[model samples]
Target: MTKVLLVEDDATIRVAVVRALGQRGHAVATAPDALTGLQLAVSERPEIVLLDLGLPDLDGREALRMLRAVSAVPVIVVTAAGAESDMVRALDAGADDYIVKPFGADQLDARIRAVLRRLGSETAAGPIVVGGLVVDARARQASVDGRRLELTPREFDLLHYLAQRPDQVVSKADLLTHVWQIPYARADKTVDVHLSWLRRKLGETALEPRYLHTVRRVGVRLSAPEALGTSPEQGTAA
Candidate 1:
């Protein structure tokens, strides 16, 4: 079941949303304010965050900024703020999706599912070939120079996702939901941990990476060293 962190000060709204999400087979954790939400986000590491803008202690936008500073978790701003400026500000602040107040539970659920599906489909389209490395999406496997790499299921999925979209940055939040099947509010360190393992297995390093390129404050891109103006022989999987 997907874990969700529901951050809302309103007791009624929190209870209703928690119940609705629970009925949908999700594990819901509620936080009464931005501080508590942030704490829960770090500790529980939910799959998604449903944040309300009007909080008693910290403003939602500030909380969002703080959260984004440490985590690449997918956050959906659920609030009464429907102004164009508000939406734009939230997006600029790193929100993945937004839902206005008075929205139906079904609509919220659909949006959540849509976000997850989009992430999942990002690498679902085709096989990727980068020099000696070949990633097959259909089989969810990877090989370099005709030698198969032993990967955990999560590693295979993560590598396949990156390879499928070579050169394009894939956000850590997207990777969490799409690959790990966990909520975005979880620690981005999880991605880092897995990526470190992936790099080691692939015989790569961050400073002189052979396959993975981390885009600062954005995400990661999988490409050949040639793509980075180095050499095609040093291409790496995403």
Candidate 2:
């Protein structure tokens, strides 16, 4: 059974979700406002959080930023706003995933399971070293050139997944399946957004990558700096 915190201002939606999750053998805790939810997030320590943006006391985005400041608990933004910009903004603010409102219980449960699976499966016997980047799966930490990278759980998962298979060009479809634990959708920009964030944390960009290299239509590959030639684009498929 998963422990879930549902933070929704709408009483009807909150009760319905709680009931649905309970029926699915999940233990859910509900809060009517963002503040209470934040308190429960830290105090109750649920494995996952389903947060709504239309809160009475605080905006969910602000709440997400605050929660990220104190904890790295996985958050899925459940909002009525289906706009792509809103989804990207929530993701940028540190959401692990985003689910539009009016979604079915089965879909929600699937997302929860995916997130938990990704989190639980990231353990390795020791740190994975690629060039100057060190990804310690056991400790769930990563560093570049002796400088630590403050990655979100999702970001770490993405990097670790690639580090485990260095130099192999992994298609976004495969990445969505193995790393995100979701079916591939051509329009989904989830991988791109996370990759951008990961690049930033690694002190590089797609244009001048040090560890991660884009293989054009193929996908992304992680390689030691020595593996590539003088140009970042060299040794990588164009």
Candidate 3:
């Protein structure tokens, strides 16, 4: 689930949005004023924040400025203000999205999702290279040495995420959360199945692995072949 911090002073709107977003699978946290919201933003480390333009303690824009100064968390302004200037100002001040009031849950949900997707794409930390494998996230392209690999969309996503942290063991649960955007309720078998296909395309297997290696009940790791201590023939079967 995505951690969402909602900063809205109005009790009715806050309750409605919190309830609706909770039903939609987002872990929602709320504050009725700017100061409390800012405090939560810094302490809780939410994935995204839904901010309001009008607040009791501090103006929403000022709060947004303070947030931008401290963190790069995606922010979507949800307010009654519909002025183009207000929208432009917020966007200029690093707001990922702007939404006017009197909107439905579906609309708000869509906006929130769009912002999070954009944020994910923007913060890839650049292309990842592991030995001969090259995954260019910005271009959504992967290659082995000079040969470009034609990967399925899921394969590419999985590879790109793994490549970002080369040599590090990433658990299936974390993969489900980051790659599948599934915070919970998904079997680890999904990751294994995809990894099997990915391994085949990379000319590897569970017994003799090159790039993607399974570490028993722990997780998987993407690393250079030489950096691994295990022999080429040594690895898990399941």
lDDT of 2 at 21: 91
**Which parts of model 2 have CA positions greater than 4 angstroms off?**
124-127, 136-140, 151-158, 172-209, 229-238
Q: Tens digits of per-residue lDDT for model 3 on 1-238? A: 9999999999999899999999999999999999899899999999999999899998888888788767767788898998756765665465767789899999999988987786577456776778998887656678886788877555777888798889888888898666655456345477888898888888888878888887776788899887878645335833
User: What is candidate 1's lDDT per residue for 165-229, written digit by digit as tens?
Assistant: 78888888888766654444444576787798898888888767877887766778888766676
Candidate 2, residues 1-238, lDDT tens digits: the string is 8999999999899889999999999999999999999999999999999999999999999999899888778888999998766865777676878899899999999989987776566653578889899998756689999999998766887898899999888888887766654444453678888888888888887668888888766788889988886644443322
Instruction: Report the number of the highest-lDDT candidate.
Output: 2
Task: Rank by TM-score, highest first.
Answer: 2, 1, 3
Q: By lDDT, rank the candidates, best first.
A: 2, 3, 1
Candidate 3 runs further than 4 Å off: 125-238
Off by over 4 Å in 1: 123-238
Model 2, residue 22: distance off in Å is 1.4
Cα RMSD (angstroms) for every candidate in the order listed = 10.7, 3.8, 14.2
Clashing pairs in 2: none
lDDT, residue 147, model 2: 97
Cα deviation at 158, candidate 1, in Å, is 20
Q: Give the Cα lDDT of each candidate.
A: 0.78, 0.84, 0.80
Which lDDT value does model 2 have at 48?
96
